[model samples]
Every structure is written in structure tokens, then in C-alpha cells.
Target: MDQYSVPAGPAAGEFRDRSSKFVAALYHVQDEAAALDAVAEQARIHNRCNHHCYAYRLGPGPDRWRANDDGEPSGTAGKPILGQIDKAGLSDILIVVSRYFGGTKLGTSGLINAYREAARLALEEVTVTQQLLLTGVRLAFGYALMTPVMSALSQLGLEMADQAFGERAEVLLELPESTASATVRELQAAIAGVYVEEVGDDFEVEGLTVLVTPTGD
Candidate 1:
């Protein structure tokens, strides 16, 4: 399956009505147990609520996951929230909706609408992108050629994660999986013809860290 992007950490939002309160929950988790734990924790924190319904997807595994409506109707709260996650094509995500009664009891349909809308609204506040396999390349260049090289790299759509200036300038770059090889080749051809230096290893880049892994390890 495709590795789509979801939020990396927990996010939350609240919606209120004259007689009901809805809290939306979203979190990124590595496994079903973790996802359930997060939901349980959130439910515990908001235990005073009338209902705590949850949905989650844990990627493809024995841990693909499940959802529960707590005490609400069987399909009202949990299923609709799960539908929102599936519609977004997002996995490794968990969402829980907590409702507090304000002297009025919303029927099953109303509960479903409130939970679904709350989940949707919370997702709208998040920025989701495709989670690409990122590769990092370090380039060292003399002062005279630095600007041109940097500009070329930028135009190639490389993410400049870090830079350090000294006798020779060093730059850390991130390239997506589809373009990593081509970008590396372009960089070598562009610099080898003009400079006398070595280009560093091609490795996976995550956030500010560059990681090197063995072929089977």
C-alpha cells in the first residue's frame, strides 16, 4: 500500500453546541496497542463525558486495528469517525470523539453527524503531505561556487535542511525517492567538472538527522 502522510503527533479540537460538547482527537501511532492506549488515555482524561468513541488504522499487520463507539449506538459515533479516516486514505492514525451532555440528548443520527464533523474539522487544521523516502546529500564547495550550487540545488527542489559556512561551505540536502538518483548524478556532474573535492554518502534524511543503514540490517 502507499505510504500516505498523516499528522506526526497528537492533535485535538473542540466543538460545542447548546446541549452537547464534542471533542475531536487525532494521533499518529506505530501499532494498534499504542493507538488503543492513546484513545484510552484521552478517554480517561475526559471520562466525565457521556461517550468516548474512537477509530484507528494501524497500517497492514496483525495490528490493522479497530474502533468502538463506547456507549453510543453501534454505528453512530465510531463508524462515522472511522469513515473519515479511511476517506482521507490515512493510516497509522487514531481519532476519538468525546461528548459531554448539556441536558439534551442527541439521537443516534445527531451523534453521528457531530462526531464526523468534529473529526473532519480537526483534520482540516492539520497539514498532511505524502511521506516520501528522503535521502540526504552533503556537498562541500569553495566560496566562489557556493551560490551557484545552492541555487541549482534549490531549483531542483531539494530541501536544504542545514548549512554551515567556513573555509569550505557544507550543506545538507533532502531529496525525495523519485529524484534522489538523478539529483545525485546532476550534482556530481556539475561539481566534478569545476572543483577538486569529494561528495559524501547518499543516506536517508529525517528531520535534521542523516541516517545510514546496512543493506539487510
Candidate 2:
């Protein structure tokens, strides 16, 4: 998948059933590690709560994800939270629902509805945004080819993440995955003596490190 939906930022939701309070907190996370960290932090914040259930989806396909029921019954908390996330077609996000029991027990269906509703409410409060998968590219070329290389990238509507000027010129680019290959080919055809290679998004260009952020089209 080239793009997917995610929460623009953090949001909170609340649900009450039979005096029990369910607080849902949503966060935008890039990977599983961040997602887990969010969950852990929520647990610490709501240390008095009885349960800290959570669900997270990551990446384009979002196949790498998990749901935790915490101390709640199997599938009572986590599954419903995950269901709400999938219903919204969202990824790279985490939702944790902390429950404060009020001397009452909610059955299986009651737990599911409470969790689902909490998650839904949290999602409703968030502004959904799209995340585009991008490919990082490093270009090295001679001074003579700098103008053409830069002009080619500009014509393609691509922006440089980082650039360095020395004996040779080096530039870092983050291209949309859909057009990365085509953009590279166009640059090669337009400029001579230019070296181009695909790199990971985290790859840093020494001497001139710049942050490359993914933007939706």
C-alpha cells in the first residue's frame, strides 16, 4: 500500500457503564516499539486503573500489529479496540483503554461494547490524516552536473532533504514510493555523471543532516 490513514495526534475518549469508567487514549506511533511504549506509559499514568488494554496497527499493510486484553477476559477488550481501528482503516496508531471498576462487573458483551464505544469515541475526536510511504534516495554528482540534477528534481516536484557542497555535490531526497523509480530514471536521463542510490529513510547524509518528513499528496 502506498498510503494509509492515521490519527493526526493524540486524543482521548470516555465511556461509562454501570458506574465503571473507561478512558481511551489514542496516539500516533511509527512502529511497534513506540506503540508498546505508549501503552506502557499509559499504564504508568493510570496506575490506579484495573486494566490497561490496547491495540496497535503499523505500516502500510498494517499486518504487523497486536492487541492486548490486559487483565480483561480474552477478546473482551483488545479485540474490540482493534476492530474499531480496522473499521476506520487506520494504521500506525495505538489506542489504550484504561478501566476503573466501580464495584461492578460487565459481562463479555458489555465489555466489548464499552471498549468498542470508547475506541470509537476517541477516533471521532481525532483528525484523520494520510501517511504516504516514501523512498529515500542519495544522489552524488560533480559540480558541473549540479544544475541539471537540481533542475531535474525540481521539475519532478521533488524536494531535497539534505544537500552538501564540496568537491562534489551530494543531495538526499525522499520520493513518494509510487514514483521513486520513475523519478530516478528521469534524473539519470536528464543529467550525466550523477550517481543515485536508494537508501533507508533513517539514512543520514553526513555534514548536512536534515529531517525528511513524509507528507500526503
Task: For each candidate, give its TM-score against the true structure.
Answer: 0.58, 0.84
In model 1, the runs with Cα more than 4 Å from the true position are: 60-63, 132-217
Candidate 2 error regions (>4 Å):
154-157, 193-217
Q: How many residue pairs clash in each candidate?
A: 0, 0
lDDT value, residue 97 of candidate 2: 98
lDDT of 2 by residue, 1-217 (tens): 6777888999999999999999999999988889989998999999999799999988787477899999899999999999999998888899999999988888999999999999999999999998878877777766766677777777667788888887778898878878876666656644533344533344333332233345433
TM-score of 2: 0.84
Lowest summed lDDT window (length 10), candidate 2: 203-212
Which candidate comes out best when scored by TM-score?
2
Alpha carbon deviation, residue 46, candidate 1 (Å): 1.0
The candidate maximizing lDDT is 2
